[model samples]
Structure formats: structure tokens, C-alpha cells
Target chain A: MITPITETDLLLFYYQEADEVTTSIIREHLPENTDWQYFLNELATISSESSSLMCSPSNTTLSIILEESRSQLEHTL
Target chain B: MNAPIIADGVLIQRYMQGNQAAFETLLNRHRNRIFTSIYLLVNDRYLAEDIFQETFIKIINNIQAGKYNHEDKFLPWAMRIARNLSIDTIRSRKRMPVVVDSEGRDVFDCLGISVQSREDEQINQDEISALKHWIRELPEEQREVLILRNYAELSFKEIAVLTNTNINTCIGRMHYAILNLRKKMQKNTVRVK
Candidate 1:
């Protein structure tokens, strides 16, 4: 009997966290299943867009951190 | 030929040996993702900056004290620290009374709508601000999983371990978070048309 492919399984597969057998099953199953295929595409789009929204700390914060690191190095030396 | 990228482990070893440049390189490499993860959780840029600084200070102390054993897993380790600090600050803030401006409006209310500095930049910033608002609306658990997965870039297994939950629960939360965000975006698009 074939184990049912679940949304959770699709998520694992999308993130490349599935084991080899599950990965193979997802690979074979996705192309033949339109709903699953659409779901995968949605995951890809959402993941890509969300991950692209990168934010950086202010330069003042960066300077403080670097100074901290420098002081630590001096203490170690 | 391009220079081969130095690994995080090598950088850590060099930094431990008093190489400040190596540590800077390491910090710059993962800075944005780490900052974004903290900011998303806290929903305030200034507060996020404070937590980010605190996170790195602790990281430097830990490394110098020879307590940084995670080696190649620097981003996730740093992210875990940042996440913890953000959570603590948030909890404390919740206990305090809300701060409002002279106009009797919540000071934080204006923060969600980012200022558009240029005409060309407005649309992108608007979209990002909308997405941020939607993410903030999500349940805390789902939002945490999404941030750890996408912003922290932790694998499901790593997230499971960091969050102290089973892998299946993490994945399920992630699935729901994505679906909910997608639904929000689609609804927004339809409304805009």
C-alpha cells in the first residue's frame, strides 16, 4: 500500500529535509498531482519572496560590535 | 580564478587566535539574516538593533571564553541567541504599559508603515510593509517557525532542536504559516485590483 503524501511531507520535501525514500516518492508524486504541484510552487514563491526581505543593523550597531570584538582580542593577546 | 570561500570554522579558529578581520568577515556574512530574524520577531527596528548588539556581545564573550563549540553552525547558533534575547525583551515589554505620543496615538503604530524615501521605492516598500504586517498578525508559534526557517535559514531538524519540538511539528507549523501568508497576499492583490 502506498503511504499518503501529506502537506507536512511536501513541506519537508520543499526544504530538502526529507529522507532519500521520501524524497524519491515526492519527486515521483508531484509531477502527476496538479494540486500538489501548485502547492509546491506556492511554497517556492513564498519562501523566495520572504527570504529576500533582508534587513541590516545600523552602522552604529556594527561599529559597537566590531569595537567589542577588538577589545576582546586585545584582552586575549 | 576566484578565491575559495573561507569556511566559518576556519574563521572562528582565526578569530580565537586574535584575528579581528576574520570575526568581521563572519559577522558581515550572516548579519542581514540575523538582524532580519530579530526584527521580524520584535517588530521594531530600534529594539531589534539593541537585541542585535546584545546578541553579538554575548557571542564575542562566549567565543573568547572558549565556549563556542558549534563550529560550522554559526548562523543557527547566533540566531538562537538573538531569538532568545528578542523573546525576553518582548516579554518584558508586554508587562509594561503601552507608550503613546502626545497626539494620543500609539508610538509603535507608525512604525509598521515604513517611510518611502523615493517615488520609485514606494511600491516595493509598501509591499514589504504589508507582508510584515501580515506576518505580525500570525499566531506567535507559527510566526516563530516561519522566521526561523526563512530568516534564520535553519533546516527543519535544526529548527526542531532549537525550538525543542519534534521535526514534524516544526514542518507542520511552517506549512500553515506559508499557506496563511499566501492567502493574505492573494486577498490583498484582489483588493488592489
Candidate 2:
């Protein structure tokens, strides 16, 4: 009997980090239609929200100051 | 910031030569990944920003001090700094319960996030929000591995090296985390039914 594909197995597959043996096993055990892919799809879909947090310091300001401050910080060397 | 595209090796060389624009280019490229990695863990915008800034500052200090050996990609090195700072903040706060201000309002909510992404605009809004929320609710060990893997895009091997654990342990933590999110989704579906 095929061992069940654990969520960790799916996670590794979703990240494309799973080995061939694990991938083949999961693929073998993958439910006919919507089971595994649904969770993985939902995960990949919302991964972008992590970046949605407000851009405090604003990207422009951060870009300028990060380098400008680095230039000045070089003076301390 | 208008600097041309250059490899990280080239950029580091330029920065070492005191060409600041190269530094800006490097920061611009990886800032979001680094910022998001830290923010997802901290769940506190202000603290995350502080960690982000400190991460960059530490990189610059190490670079200038002749210490930063770019054995791996520049982003991972910078991310390591961000992760350490964020975890340090968490450790310090672990002893004291999160306290509300005298007004009994969440003082943290004052520093709201600003640049939310529209990449997943096509997805179901409520489902995506719930999934994201559940991921945040995961235990720290599991959540850190997920954030490092998914958001930061670190390999299990890289995560093991960074977190100083065995690769199997990292994978195990990720397993439990995804399982936790899946169960939460199932529970939500059941409630709806």
C-alpha cells in the first residue's frame, strides 16, 4: 500500500524541494481531482501578501538613505 | 537607485570601492524579500522595520570591517542578519506579556502596513486572508521555517544551515506547519457547512 502523503511532503513539493522519489510517491497518492493541489495553490496564491505590509520609510526613501547612509558610514572605517 | 543591472558580486565590489549607487541597487533588489521575511515573523510593523534597517546596517558594518565573506548570495547573508535581529526582539519580549497601552488599544496597530501587494488579486479575498492569518498563528518554530522557506525562498538545506539545525528537523517543522494550516482550513470549511 502507498503510504499517505503528509502535509510536509506536499509543502516540500510546493516549494519544489522534494526529491524524485518523494515526488513520485506523492504523485501516486495524489487524490483524483482537487485534494492536494488545492492547498498548494492556495498557498502559492497568498504568498505575496507577506509583502503587503506597509512600506514604512517608503521604498524610495529607503533606497536613497540606505546607500547614502552607507556612504557616510564608510567614513567611520 | 537608477544603477544598471549588475551581478551581486559586481555590486559588492562597487560598494567596497565606495560606489554607493551599487549599494542602493543591491538593497532595492532584495529589500522586499528581506522586509517581508522579518515582518511575517515579528507581526509588528515598527519592530520589523527596525530589524530591516539594522540588518542593512550590520551588513554595511561587516563589509567595511573586512568581515563579510560573500560565500553565498548577498540576499541570504542580509536575510540572516534580519532574521537574527527579529528573533532577538522576540526573545526579549517573551518574558513580558504583550501589554496594551493605558488606552487599552493595541499600540502596534498605529504603525499600519502601507504597501500591500495585488499579485493575488484574482484569488478569493477572504480565503487568502484566512490562510495568511492561519500561517501567522502557527507556533514560532514551525512558522519561522515556513516564512524562511516560502517567503524568503530558502532551501531546506540553507534553512538548516542558517537556523543551525539538521535538514530533517527543518522539514519536520514545515510538515507540522502546513498540516496545521490545512486543519484550520478544514475547520473553517466545516463551520461554513
List lDDT for all candidates, in order. Answer: 0.84, 0.71
In terms of TM-score, which candidate is strongest?
A: 1
lDDT of 1 by residue, B1-193 (tens): 9988998888988999989999999999989989999988887777888999999999999999999985448877888899889989989977876668899876655565322223224335435556667888999999999998888889988888888999888888888898898889888864211
In Å, residue B29's CA in model 2 sits off its true spot by 1.1
Docking class of 2: acceptable
Candidate 1 residues A1-77, lDDT tens each?
Answer: 66888888788888888888888988887778998898888888777777656778999999999999999999998
For each candidate in turn, the TM-score is 0.86, 0.72
True contacts kept of each: 0.90, 0.18
- What 10-residue stretch in candidate 1 chain A is worst by lDDT? A46-55
Candidate 1 chain B, which ten residues in sequence have the lowest lDDT sum? Answer: B113-122
Docking class of 1: medium
TM-score of each model's chain B: 0.82, 0.77
